[model samples]
Target: MAVLLGPPALAADPAPPSAQGPAFIDWSGPYLGIEGSGGASFGQHTFHGTMIGGRAVPDFKTGDATGRNDRSRNATTAVGGLFGGYNWQTGPWLYGIEADVYGANLKRPVASTAPGLGYEGLDPEFSVLRAKTDLYGTLRGRVGVAFDRALVYATFGLAGADVRILATYPDLAGGGVASTRHDLSYLGFTLGAGVQLALTEQLALGIDYRYLDLGGGGRFGLGALPGAAGGPVSTRDASFTSHQMMARLSWHPAGLTPPPETEGTSSPDDRFSLHGQTTFITQGVPGFRAPYTGPASLIGRQVQSTTTATMMLGLKLFEGTELYYNPEFSQGFGLSRTLGVAGFVNGEAQKAGAPYPKLRSNRYFLKQTFGLGGETEDVPDGPNQVATRRAIERVTVVAGKFAIGDYFDANSYAHDPRVDFMNWGLWASGAYDFPANLPGFTQGVMVEYNRPEFALRAAYTQVPKEPSNDVLDPRVFERAGGVVEFEERHVLPVLDQPGKLRLGLFSNVGNTADFRQVVGLTQAGLFADINDAAAATRRPRRKTGFYVNLEQAVSADLGVFARVSANDGRNESLSFTDIDRSVSGGVSLKGTAWERPADTVGIGTSMNGISPSHRAFFANGGVGLLIGDGRLRYAPERALEAYYALSLNKILTVSFNYQLVVNPAYNKDRGPANFLGTRIHADF
Candidate 1:
């Protein structure tokens, strides 16, 4: 998120803007920069005698008291931040002031045990120390000497840091462990020197080293002992120092002199556009409910990773017709082959079953638009769009092999699993069981009518050849799915923000088994297994469902989204998950208050349930694509997820996510689980 502060560079300077050129480099003006550093911190702490009953216990010293309790630790760290400053230049001397803040992962823990400090046969003495430096900032003044295209500078600054300390004892007399944490703020000093080289009038790169001393001997009392009620029995002092080296990239927008005008003008070919994105996600559930008596219980404590790369190419073939193609490469499997949870943890974790990377022609489509004489809007050239003006009142017809979700059930905030919520139910209407292949796509045709305030959309897509099949049925007339949706967009006058609401009706016809039939056959003892009965009863069953979606912008930096969907549970799930009903909602917040506008935080929850017939089949040992806990203690599957995404730069982002799932697989007998995830994504 670095911003260049200078004007455009002059193409024809009296001389070239370089060290060897005739023009002298100007090191004046304000600049914004970003820096990354990797370093280590060194620190030491000293402990005093234990305090009990508001008095020092002579025999309870940590280690004979003469600095024997002193401990030292070192930690490796990584830090990154943004910086802004202005430089004043007079002749060859340069002076500047800069301010910056950084976030760091720097922590160390120390522990010790004492055998002689026990009370009533209980070892009541243990010392545990934990210290960390989470954040730090600097306000500095700089002095430098400038060369033609380079500058060498020295800096001194007032530095402030936040440090955390924790002390704990395991054997508290009555029961649980006793612990206390202290958050300390320290003001110190920093000194550094660096050299910068101008790559252009607007861009420069530099490397710098700094020594930071966060002062020493900040004393704090440790109140209460493990076995004895006390106050101020022991005291501790903590300090930290670090040597850091960072590489910086700075942009001076005001220093960029405009280039000379050229004689020829070339217009971009806006009719053709290409865009691509790549996302890599790794997620793990450290522990969950154990394996059940059933055949398809979830495997607890597992890690899985997935990667997807997609290239979207588009061409405007005619005034009202356009064509799009998306070729994608995908690798990796979901946790337990995407099993155990009715609402799976990762939406992008397709059922590809590929142990290695596989390439697929994911989508190809053609769209034609007819204008009905209305306001015009400019469309950006990206992905499937061409840079052109489009009539607000238009009818569009699309025929393609693509994911039905690409057009229908679209949500402005929650639909994209790559960027927004990642759970299956949160990303789409789970119970719709929309037609698709194993990777969630199918050949489809759609029609849409649009206006300033409302729109109507409908689509019919090919269903899988069989239940959970990896290929589409191909006989679109016999095995297919259709959906129609109406959308309304309006402004909330009170909030002064735009919002959209959508209602959709969908139906799928596929060679699927009826849940009640499977249960009925199992009870009749005609077949001992419900799956066998289900296979015997396979036929083209029609499942109908509907969904409601809403997205509201509460403010410029916050938004809310919600979805509720349900389907008739008579037929087996042909695509997507096993849930017959689902409701999900969440809010996304941008980090504008904290000043990192590119960062985002989101929290969401979903509840999924099966119909009576579907539950009975599972209770009688029937398995769907992802879930089958043999016998069922039926309970709705519920999950809560939250994530924080930090934008390292324009093309890269790192996100940390956590999900708590209750009654995974809709089996009350099985666990409430926890899933942690990390995602790295890049787009261009």
Candidate 2:
């Protein structure tokens, strides 16, 4: 995905005028919207010529060993974007100009489509070709007619896109793979039509169709493949066209006012709460030293970006009961698709990434609180939380799909990646191996007891079916993860500063193979493959760990935090990253000393180690959840992160960050990488 995209600009406009005719919908004013799109492509694809080891073949038919052509295959996928425009309406007629950019994954694959000439035995070879477009944008003019609360419109626009072509095939002569890649900028045009229905004075819903014609002309150098030498120097061209359908919702800035400044500090009466937020983060790494590479080693250079937008809805069902649901849209990829580094540089990156935005219900849970009859304290209004007074000593129960991190291992100075830290080692316990799906979310039941001096939390949740896998197990009790944590709060004698200490014990029960077991079995010939050992050993197994988290406030404007975690290294990591033991700590400073009270600065560092068997496993060519250098030089992986945040306004903040990773994935031969990143976040 493009790394330059940031969050859309937001502004408030006066409510649409009702003077036009109180009852007639006025389709004029500046409006912003979010859309979900899905579409397909229909275009002609072909191969013009071929050459094998300097020998030219003027005419060759494209086909594979199967005697079939899947090239020019139909392309279908989903897309997401944001749009804004200003409209002017006169009676039932309206005109406007709009601009929008989308996250997209449009690619077609061609395989075994070239022929090897003049090579007797190496005939019927194989090669692969991929045409990819990650992102595109449009600027269009719109004309529409309004009939009461409904509007019909047509749009025409200029479009531009990022295009890439990749081809890979076997090198028959050298017994290796030969590849070629071409990246370019494409300019095209779009035509579309749509209808909108006004749902309220400041809200509307619409659906539209677009035909995008991104004409293309590019050629690739083909390689020699095994069914004989497929080709040493072959070339092919490209064509691009797509039909897209989109659904959108528009909102006026005045539709939802932000919470007051004192919302979280003072008590307020509240039965319902609605809030929304979005964050965009982009990262890049410059060139570095790497004498060699493997399946899981971080490349020397790369840039990537990700975007997420979420809406929170909370309602009080009764006195001590509430329900909350969070819906979200996420797009883009992590560095190297979230591989190579043990403590990855981007905490927000997901292992399962999509070329376009994907929408899903992130959290849906029911919470009930039981008072134990003590002094009461006011809880703030925010995402998934309602403003209310709760007993200082109480018991709370939550059930449904959620993340276990919501209730445990919290450090005021370093917990949330969105606000404080961007490194996984800093924001979470790298060795905890907490249960989760690809996006780090799981289904579970959690209970907590809170008192003025201390708190105890516990939960049982579903885990991924296998290491490096995205799907969570459906049988909760049969394959589950559980944890218990205890936290103590105290005040320092002279500074009178507040501080907390937490200790957590966790365990996972699944069918994961022990590192030693797999290696030993493969050596003894009992197992056919070391990588497939987990399937052979199907009995239940347990992995356990413990962690200590500490956070203290040196003053109202400064805080320091530290964490130490360890887990048994015999079994594979059930979730989380690829570390078996870790220690991390840091200090945070607010700019009050410099008269910029809204700014913050922080520095943190971590060292991650693996168990002997885990190290041996990797040295033997076995791969883990986040690491595997094919071979290992065996060293503890170390990471350092530093960041600064500037509050631009009440609704937005911008942050800059830098990281140093030494011996990534515990391999000493490969790196000492430097990564730089920027984050833009908005909340209400």
Best by lDDT: 1
lDDT for 216 (candidate 2): 57
TM-score result, candidate 2 = 0.73
Report per-prediction Cα RMSD to one decimal.
16.0, 8.9
- How well is each residue in 1-684 modelled by candidate 2, as lDDT tens digits? 011122212122333354223323567778899986433222223333333345443333434323222245445556788988888778778899999888777766644434444333433444456667788799999998764445668899998878776666555556776777767677889887666655444666565556678775555554443435443554444556666556677886544222112214324479887776666677888877777777777886777667666779999898889999998766666787778899998888872265545677889999999999969877888778888888989999999878778888988889888888988899998899999888878889999999989999999998888875678888887899999999999999988999999999999987687888877877788866566665576456799999999999999999999999999988888788888999999999998877667778999999999999998778867777777777898999999999998765445567999999999988889789999988766665
In model 2, how large is the Cα lDDT of residue 670?
A: 77
Candidate 2 RMSD to the correct structure = 8.9
lDDT of 1 by residue, 1-684 (tens): 233212223324343334233223567899999986533122333233333344433323334534324454555466778999999877778899999988877776643444333434444333455677888899999999764455768999988889877766654567778778877888889987666656555776665556688775545765455664434334445666765555578999888332223321112346877666667677788766565645656787666667666778888898888999998867666888778788889888883345434679889999999999968776766566766677999999999888888887888777887887888878898787888888888998999999999999999888887888887887887878999999999999999999999999998899999887788878999998889999988988899999999999999999999999999888898988898999999999998888778788989999999999998988888899889878888888999989888765444456888999999988878888889987766564
Residue 221's lDDT within candidate 1 is 60
Clash count list over all predictions: 15, 5
Q: Can you give the TM-score per candidate against the true fold?
A: 0.63, 0.73
